[model samples]
Target chain A: MDLAPPIRFELRRGAVTAIPLAIAVGLFGVSFGVLSASTGGMGALPAIVMSATTFAGSAQFAAASVLAGGGGPVTAILAALLLNARYLPIGVSVARFMLGGRVARFVQSQLVVDESWAIASRGGGEFDPHRLVGAGVVLWCAWVAGTVIGVLGGEALGDPAALGLDAAFPALFLALLVPQLGGRRARAAAALGAGIAVVLVPFTPAGVPIIAAAGAAVIGLVRR
Target chain B: MSESWAIVLAVGAGTMAIKAAGPVLLGSRPLPAQVQRVVALLAPALLAALVATAALASGQQLVIDARLLGLAAAAVALALRAPVLLVGAIAAAAAAVARLAGLG
Candidate 1:
């Protein structure tokens, strides 16, 4: 369907799609910032830094959980790394776009996540790099803003877990997941990657599973 | 603020490395078409992996508890294509209620 829809269509769809997902991601991130702040011993600064760079909610949450629970830096880092290893494949998968500008490519990979990638891909073929960048920019701003909100919101709640606000994070992931299951390969690959990731949790470090599963899947993908 | 410098550096460095690692690692050769195809699914796989670990595990053991209850509730919400905000709230509420009820 090379129907080159007006760039306007791509722009509109990209913005619309990116906004809600960004908000969802922002809600999750804000909860994380608040949770990190709630630890009493940690600073809001550290949490924000984690969110800005890591930008990975689950691993960041896991890292914060471990850190707050008195885990060592090594433990926290390992947890975060293992959990975030998924990004490696995400980076590789999207690397094709990074070809033109090495620097931009690097930056792009860093920010790619469930929200941005999904939104960008949906822009259809009409969705050019510009729209993708626009979507990412929107999501990034929203996430950071939401983090502040979540930080303040968490404090006001005093215990976000009390109101079950914590669940919003996972719920956000759920919303992103349905739209992503676009094909059999994707669904099967995801199932395999996740199953491997879950089973390997106890043995592997936090970030290793996604990388491992992606590695495993790559072999299959390449073989076929 | 001083501590934030190191944290900021770390964040910046981390992003720089992960972003750079791809091209540096892959060089010029395109990934096999199959692998490129599979790469598309990494998001969901990662999502499921994270979701399961978060909701289904307690410490080192697998336990069916409030978290699981919440996740299950959220799954229903997802199936129904409920809005994200409502889904998250209901899931968490379900988990909290289950915890309160001792049924988890």
Candidate 2:
């Protein structure tokens, strides 16, 4: 067994590092809550519940957007599924690091979000499960809490776009993406992924292009 | 059940199931060599796609708007090795300012 630090230490480290991201996520969650509340179809209770349970920002936003546009639940669900398909590969990447039995492992796996996973990654397919869980917990709390605030009193906060919160998501992702583009293969995948997404956006439905862009990563399968 | 409740529950369950599928099935087993290679690249590819979609696309139309300014400002911040939070703040400020100036 690898002599790792105690879980608490790693967890604290994860939580500490994640605090900044968590604040941003909370702000995004506020935007989501405000948007969902403004949708007219969804109430505060359901919006909060969605944030608490669904816990995926992009997917939740897509679903809410569908509802806002007067689309039915089926369309909303499909859109969310398209956005969430990335989790399948993400989960597989982190599986070997996950510990515990069936139930425990499953609960812990709930912590596998993009931010948490990135924070936990130690490169070359190694992941620190405790850190993943830690960061996930912090972010989850922030998301849910922010949603509650937004759902309860979002009207007072005024428009999120006016505050430029919408730009935060792209910026956060860009920050995360830059560090990963250190190698030639990663840079190639990023360029390919961005191109695929841009090319497909006009033709495909929302979220579809994003998942389809994952195919760009297959470039890594080529012999170097 | 109400339609809203149904949507919420269905989405919640579906997302949870999707999130659990890979970890539950794979357990602690190591990924195969080819899979590992691809997996390593997945973060970069997916993140880039997210950045593009979030920054450029609005619904079906790829509009050139304040978000582009935000992204450009973010790129500058990243080049300067700014912290993540600062990068987000700078990007948000840039976009908000551009929008205030009626540029989109």
Candidate 3:
């Protein structure tokens, strides 16, 4: 099938749909950049490069916090790796939509961040590859741009907390989640997941709680 | 400094590998039915988990603070079917005002 026009439409829709998320992600990136500059021993180039390459905010934040606290490099990297392990399942879930040849698959896989994944998965069973890629590109650009701005204006940006941008991340996620809670099963799964995460927050490492919460989806599978 | 750089490089490489693992291993094969159902549910589950943690916790402990109020405002905005950007803006504004009022 000729997938061009549909892909194009989805791409445009995805980019437009992602603007808010891109903005929130940009703010988060700015916070990371400022923190990296101040305490992570990361200069502007390294900070930009990390944001561009890793493109994962929580992992970057974890690594930066560890480094700032004088933790060893190995320890920081390990923490980041553990935090990022959640991507493995996300990648698997999105793999089918990563259409095309080996090269295309490899290239598209790099765009698999949380926002893109969430947007792409919202298509109810029909995963849209174009939407995923389009959202990924916009988010990547926003994140990189935000990091550059933050690094250059590190001191001027001050603490993102003061501006209350720290709340933006959760706000965006909650917004995305509300629309998905339409069905009883979905609501149950989400409630279970939230409960698991809240209970584990004080016990587990930072990212582990979320990954563990992903297990709550088994309720959906069991009910099916 | 070099150690920091090395750590960054290692993390970059490690994260890339993790991101690539699913596509590399799973390929284009359709997931099994039960797995597919679970995968379908993963987004809502993981996202809710993230929201709970992000809004309520700071470091190791859960805090009742401006962030909670901001989240509540954002929830109201979302329930009203406001645009995603507006929801985030409302949340941020609510938190900022609450903080200014020494709420947190």
What is the alpha-carbon lDDT of model 3 when measured against the actual structure?
0.85
Q: Give stretches of model 2 more than 4 Å off.
A: A1-5
- How much is A97 displaced in model 1, in angstroms? 3.0
- For all predicted structures, in order, the TM-scores are 0.78, 0.96, 0.96
Provide the lowest-lDDT 10-residue window in model 3 chain B.
Answer: B1-10
lDDT of 3 by residue, A1-224 (tens): 46678788999888888889999999888888888888655666788899989988899888888888888888788888888888988898888878877778877888989888878765444467888988999999999999888888889867788798988778999988887786777888899999999999899877888889989888866744
Residue A145 C-alpha lDDT in model 2: 94
Positional deviation of residue A155's Cα in model 1 after best superposition, in angstroms: 3.1
Q: Give me the displacement of residue A159 in model 1, in angstroms.
A: 2.4
Q: What value does DockQ give for candidate 2?
A: 0.81
Q: What is the lDDT of candidate 2?
A: 0.87
Task: Point out the higher-scoring one by DockQ: 2 or 3.
Answer: 2
Q: What does the lDDT read for residue B69 in candidate 3?
A: 91
DockQ of each: 0.44, 0.81, 0.78
**lDDT of model 2 at position B79:** 95
lDDT of 2 by residue, A58-162 (tens): 899898889888888899989988888889888888888888888988898787788998888776557888889889999999999998888878789988787
Q: What is the lDDT of residue A27 in candidate 2?
A: 89
